[model samples]
Target: MTLEETAILGCALQWPDESLPFLTEAGIRADTFSHEIPSAIFTAIATAWLAKAPGGFVGIATALGDRLDALGGAATLQTAIEGAAQPVTLPHYAEIVKEGHSKRRLALALKAAYKQLTTEPTGTVLAAIEAEISSIAAGRDKARIQSTREIVMSVLGNLNSRTDGSKMAGLSTGIVRLDEETGGIRKGGYWVIAGPTKGGKSALVRYIVRAVALDQAKPVLVFGLEMSSDDTVEAMLATEGKVSASRMRDGTMHEMDFPKLQAAANNLALAPIFFRDDVYDLAGIRSYVRQVKAIQPDLAVVVVDYLQLTEGAGSADRREQEIAIVSKALRRMAKDENLAVIALAQLNDDGELRECRAIGMDATVQVTIEMCEDEPGARLLRLRQRQGKTGVVVPVVFNGETFEWHPLAHEPEPASGKSFNRKRK
Candidate 1:
């Protein structure tokens, strides 16, 4: 161990209370210690601090009486104390220890990255590097507590700037009626829309992204893990170009449809949407978002085509555990990044979502979309919002050619099973 590291550890052991704040604030984890004995000692001290018990070496030794000799006993403690620097400079010394530890970690990580570069694609290697750098930056910039008065003043400033009395504080989702009901999408919000097979989940998500990115001019990151990027682009083109998706897929588009398709393609080519279909892991998504955000700091939204497909780090054998982990990470990302997240989920007939119950638990707004039996081109969006109202169903009509959903032209009789079309007034 370096002289500075030894001194910091020694200070932490002898004057635990006096040095606790400095060590903690230095963002030093037990692994940061160079030697096994000091690492173990630091771990014990951290445990004592959390438990609000005596944090001195004697107290730590007593707590780990059985393992004291393994941690080098009194001799090790004496050596650390003898080498210790001034207690007043403990924080400064702790920072040096932390910097050394970080360099060691970075070296190890870079070694692995070098191996990955030979085996993995360039994008994959870059993403891994981005993730590592972001993790380090986050540790350095961890948020501190804020005063309630200061928080209130900041919130008031936000409220005062908005001319609309609308409570929504984020980008609009582009659906007029849905926006009215939910007050538009809100910052740091997790929203889930669940539906059955062929329930237009992808269609709905695309429209929202198109609105936020193309029309509203906000940057968007979309993860389309279920489908290939090429297919996603084609579907979007069909929806935006007013061309029949089947015709486009079959290469049966009419001569007249060529103009519309070209127009839509040109418009979308300049959109602020960033699309990816490869990543399926939560960590990769976080890394990719951070990499993109560096260039477009104004990124306002993230959309995942479906939730069940995403995987995480740990052994998630059970479906519920997997869901919980994925949902929690996504929720944290939304809050930390302060962007709206729209995750689509599949629903079983029993009213249970596939894979996890955490989808409903973590979502700020849970919405269900199903075909409107009485209306051929319309779907019902049943809103169950935890942040606002619940049990409200907004009728929406989808123009299959345009792939857009709009408010119902007129109110319909309750449970009336009459078929209808998308004729707007």
Candidate 2:
């Protein structure tokens, strides 16, 4: 093993509390070491550290357990400590390890890319290069294990830091009760919005987009699988301008409508939002998000305008199974990137999420939209949050003219012949 690798490993084996944190923060994983022997030693040290194993070479031995002989054993560990560098310059050694890993990765990638030059298509060769560079630039961090105590303490700290009137933990969902009950759409959350045909699925998402975009000025991204790019913009224009969508569609707006449209466009331009109406397949969606995240890391939320439209891998599976694969992928992406994703789903005639029950199974929060029984122009959003509450119906009225939603005072009571759609006081 290299002297730098031994020093780093020795530092970790000796002063795990001090050096392990740095090693983890510096993105040092077991594979970062060039040789398998050092890599095995490093892996054991990390396992012991996270499990709160005892200090010194004994701790490393304890972690390795029965498999100690498979590695260089306790005697080789002695060599590591005998050649140990002081913990003060651990950061420098860690940097060397990272640099060496990058160089190796780059050289290997270039060799493979060169081979592809003759055999593969131009696009395939460029893809290989781009993937490698992106990987190198990302410097993927191996996760540091967090104890339950640490997690609860973090929750406590977050709650304590909130201002007196801070109701939500993430972006506002535009409904007061929904925000208060579920703490809004959160980072690393996967939300499923399901509804029947013409049941305000698009309208609800548009309301959230508007709330996040123009209302809060947060960066938002929308993948309009079912909606055209021009249609998405046109709908936004009508909604923001408070112009009748039908009139806008029919091109029958009065002369004064031009100024309103212009003003709405001006207002929308203030919000940093992107639309990928052409992205349909899963690879395209993931690639676009990765590219955007590389440039704009603080991208708040991603909206998939109806999930059932997008094509995914595992295409040979049964239709329902394929959809389940897609749903799992969407959920995985949100968790991997620490991103919030809202995927709209179509409901069957029986008002259940169509094709894949996994869509609801994987969602952190699932909301189903149903039209109000008595109020023709309004819809009720029934929320079933995995970690929060269930059996909560949020009444919302749709203003078709401006393409907006207003919260109603209470849930509808159709049995009593009272369907209230009045705005909440």
Candidate 3:
């Protein structure tokens, strides 16, 4: 028998009440004990304790009766008594047994998956394995409780590390006033960038990618579901080189733009901005994120161009249900991976989300972008913010030629018939 099994059994026989909490917390059951004697002894002890009977070694042995006699009766009891672990260390010993149990459970699950693989469809097998794994993780998290002091210390750590309240606590979007209002993009944040079709949502995300990855020298992953990877790259190149996307697309770039385009390409070559335009579902996105995180631990953010375009698991028949699943999965992924997720979404003129309202509710920050009726570019309105005020609209300047956007720089107009603020490019 392993020392852990022996320790747990000994504690259960001698100090049932003391070991109960650890056993309960660890979710250890009688079947978890490796040895038959230990398992039986633990079962008897637990039964006696639950029944309000005296649960000492003798009491447990009596309760066990012939089962103990078959295992050597008094001598077995004496051995367990002599080898009893310290009462103070019961929890530690329980953890050891719990870890072993977890490993055994995983092995069993793998075996079951392997058996099913021969007869089941690949997707079913994979889903079964994933479900089991998720269940294990969920069980652990459910059992683990964080104290208020620990949470407070975590909050304090975040607060103490930031010298400026107005600055972003996480990755900066590179817009000064917007950063001040939204406190910048943060890890575990679910941000929705909503706008009408072709209303500069992609341009905004491109700027965000440049700000977070290129300018700040961090890593970012983009899931460009709406466009091909090459098209995404070209758009970024135009934004970076300050060239016209149309000119680049038609191979009609001016002679003077060659050097600028080359420079932009070189900068992008060195930038740690990763892109994948082929992912069409949430599982694919999650798998890709895991792969990227494994290779690039410093990955700071994940941008998905238009959430409604992505599919969900196979069972979701309705679009809204599919979107709900995707939204929850994306949010869970952000928290699980500890990264900011900026997912682009589409909004109608009535200000309702295009596919699912769940995205609006699930998002940590909901921002709507619309073209300024009186101006040239778009205005970003904070529809909802978890940590800040909403309804704040910030003017944005979009360079049509470059497909880049930034805060509009307001310039004072001279006293005239039509006095107005104009944004200089």
Candidate 4:
């Protein structure tokens, strides 16, 4: 063994508080203690002695000494320890001391010592360890990636499946033509409903939640970041009862809507839908989705009212960066958990609202709903299916009184005007 190793072993052998001073007098530094072998190898030995010692330094040192002498003669060991106390200056020692043992510097020191003793290139040694870790990680990631792809494929395949030749689940809103064009919300596929401020995104989401959860009995989870749980519930009740959200909040339902309100409340209470208003962080949302899935293994759908409201691990340079991180995470969670995740996003500065052209989504299908006074009470839901197809626009009408989405009775012809006449002929 090298002189350094011998000294470390000696220190490790002598652990008692009384003996610690002798080690210091012998020139060993106490605070620089490390359990790393060869370099901090003595520290590990000292710790092991300390674990056995009851009172303090004295008992530990005694126990350690006993083990060392049994392995070799004390005189021979002393020879090995004689010149081992040469002082060596460590870079960033002050910073390391300030940061404590777990800092990166300490880790690097131990790693360097290990590399030197093993006579291996530092990069090669690190790569070997990393390769082992990466190998295990790759296996796990491969499984996850495959499973996610399968879930998305399954959902899409089911939606387009022709065995029954009927729509799987109709769009919750009254927009019939829109429903016919896009085939109702497909399972396992992500849907983005984005628009500008005051575009009634929240209202539109509430309508879908009520339709799917209450009316259709599909298990849905809504991550309501923009609104409180109570407010979400109230809005849902309003949509269900065919009453204005204001009336529901005020507890003043019209006599005509009383029966509908009662039924809606009953439906909501029994629905399998779960709402989580507390999930504001992106990581928290990911965790909650896992937890929800654990309970409802077959959870069909998840909805985030709007993506911009969600927070990530830390604030970024701009809102766009934050949204990008959140968007990627949400898409990952969707595929990982095998559930359809529908997230609402806001439009850019430009007034143009189209699904395929919508910015910020890395995965899943996107649909933009443009609300304008010219198209009063009507929402133009532009459908852009990225994985499959694109360029399909369907006009949908929102019934103010019923709080429902209905497809326009007549499908709007393309702006080209040629298609309309071609169809007529």
Candidate 5:
């Protein structure tokens, strides 16, 4: 009747009633009834027995009564049986009957019991438990093999998809020709918008963010490392309100602009766009991405103000090396999160102006905007789409006030004159 004897009996009688006589002949019953058993142990044994038994209520009740008598009196046995049954609900009992009590179930039961006993779910304790589960589930030995295969397949898929250039979302950049050529900017791409100093990189990113996040109502996260959160918000307001950046800074908005500004502010306040001014290194950025994914799993895009400003964990021989690392991370994050990451990158100085190029072969599209002094403050936007090629090219004017790109009209190419008048020799 002791706990140990009851456990032995439970295990021995677990299979069938056919085994019980053998167990009794082996002195199991004599040993079990020699000392008083814990009621809990007796209840567990009786439950296990009844679970496998085909007997009706009379047989089960008889066994239960005998076990209760061996484990002290009926009241003590009933109390323990009630306590044990409280933990195993009808659903849980059914599950145990179906799948049997696994180690995982036992652990879960222990955890639930601990939580019930403590009456608290602190972060540290919960995290430890979660970590244990994750670690067990990870199967570390297979990680390297699985990771290698995943990377290979991902790269291959990207390569195969790149042959047919990306489709762009309709941006309000007014550049009909550029939009026609490159589609808009495809989702799930690391779009590098690079230009020289004062070349309106930030403005361009702001334009895209507004066009995509506001106009399209797609959720976006803007990581503004260079600008403060307030400055970024002000820039967005300026773009949305069609006010000049200078006017916003100087607080010298025209009387007519007030209504537009008020409307922009109201819209912005309710926008599903999120902005973070934290100067995150690559690791920090990755962590932020994970947090964002947990909350807004359906995020449409992420916009990093510029790549060069962000820090990463590498001792690059040059700044480009660091930029490459950051670029790859952004691309990977975009693919993993299934969101478009439009990152602004700074171009290396080429004479007086820096021009944009696709950072790596991973990018889905690349766009370069050049400001021309010949036309007296006209801007030319050139696009290089990764997938398909469309023979469309034109000049686009950047409206800093509204942060809009307006396509400029161009004259048709002059017809070449032929020397038909030349005498044949």
Candidate 6:
């Protein structure tokens, strides 16, 4: 048995109540211990504690029952007692034990990756490795038991970090009024943008991608499930360059449109917008994010072009549960990765979400687009916001030809079709 694991187990049995919290908080479970005795002992002690049994030998044995007897019971208990350290050092020993566990898991992951390399795609293998390593790393961030003062102080610090409350509190959405109302797209936020077909949900995502990735120079990721990566980029070019989509689609662009397309492509070539339309499952999305995050740790946004198309953990017949799983995972991923996750959703003609309501329940902010005859264009309503004001309406003007959409107050006119590469032949 590793000394650290044995020592930590000893500490837990000695003062189970005091030590269990630290061990669990440090991400230590039975699996965390490599050795036989330590793992069993930790499990037994945990079982005993959960049953409200005493921390003493008899109580733990009663709680763990056959578990202890199967592991050489009293003799093992005595051995742990002899090796026991004080609860004061529990945290230190827990850290050491956690490190050992991570190393063990890392080795296993590498071996598995190696075995699969001959059969798996290179990117798949790499993504698995990346996700496994990231999981290990995340285990180190122990959840703290915070006092009210500590919680308040943390909130204040977050507020102060903004530097100026007069501006949007989070990453800017590039729409001024929306930012003022909803405080921009917050880090660790799960935002659901819902609309019927051709209501400009995808357009909004593209606008945000361009705003954050190009204008703000922040990294952005997009998963366009309905469109291929190349086609998505062409669509972006059409909107951003003021080139006609039909013309681009047919390779029939006029002479003047060439520079505009070239300029758009040039701007996009190096911009930190990573697009992948191949991913159709949540695991793939998670793996892709983990891989991208390694390089761009500051990646700010993730857009799932439409939610219903993505596969979740459930079976084909259980669509609702599957969507719930997908929705919850997206929200959790946003929190875990500290980025804004914008998941577009399909809406019915009556403006209800086409699929699961769990999408809205899991969202920090949920907005839907609808058209009103009295309104000049579409109306985007903030139906729900967990952290801010709701029922706010933003007037939207969308140019279907240009694929440009924005709140009326902050709408920038469509690109002027200006030619670039002056002084050329």
How far is 113's C-alpha from truth in model 1 (Å)?
Answer: 40
TM-scores for all candidates: the values are 0.63, 0.64, 0.61, 0.56, 0.55, 0.60
Q: For candidate 5, which ten residues in a row score worst on lDDT?
A: 416-425
Error of 6 at 133 (Å): 16
Top candidate, metric lDDT: 2
Report the C-alpha lDDT of model 2 over 1-425, residue by residue, as the tens digit: 88899898888778887887667657777778898888888877765554345768987787677778877778879988987878899988988988898888889879987986897778877865776777787886323333466699988876875656654587898877778778888989999998888777887888888888778877788999888767877888888898999999898999989999999998876666777787888888887676555334567888998888878885645878878888888888888877799999998765667887778889999888767666777777777788977757787788877778888887764323422212110
Tens-digit lDDT track for model 6 on 1-425?
77777677678777876877656655677777887767777766765554344776666666667777777877777777778878988778778878888898889989988997998778877877887788778883223233466689978887876666644567777676667778888889999988778767887778778888888888898999997778778888987798888888788889999999899888887577877788899998987776555435578999998899999865647787888889999999999888999999997654566778678788998877655444446444444688777666666776665677666654222123211111111
Once superposed on the true structure, which residue ranges of model 2 sit more than 4 Å away at CA? 1-138, 141-153, 161-163, 413-425
lDDT of 5 by residue, 92-182 (tens): 3323322322344437745764774575446545554555545434421112112355689976776565556442343433345666676
Off by over 4 Å in 3: 1-151, 161-167, 409-425
Top TM-score prediction, candidate number: 2
Give lDDT tens digits, candidate 4, residues 314-406. Answer: 877766666777777777777777777788877654543322232334545666666634456776666666654465666677666456676
Q: Name model 5 segments beyond 4 Å from true.
A: 1-176, 315-318, 351-360, 390-394, 411-425
List clash counts for every candidate, in order.
Answer: 0, 0, 0, 19, 7, 0
For model 5, which pairs clash? 1-32, 1-33, 1-37, 165-387, 165-388, 168-184, 168-185
Task: Provide the lDDT at 157 for model 6.
Answer: 82
Candidate 5 vs. true structure, TM-score: 0.55
Q: How would the candidate models be sorted by TM-score, starting from the highest?
A: 2, 1, 3, 6, 4, 5
Candidates' C-alpha lDDT: 0.75, 0.78, 0.76, 0.57, 0.56, 0.75
- Sort all candidates by lDDT, best to worst: 2, 3, 1, 6, 4, 5
Model 3 lDDT on a 0 to 1 scale: 0.76
- Give the Å shift of residue 356 in candidate 5: 11
Error of 6 at 254 (Å): 3.1
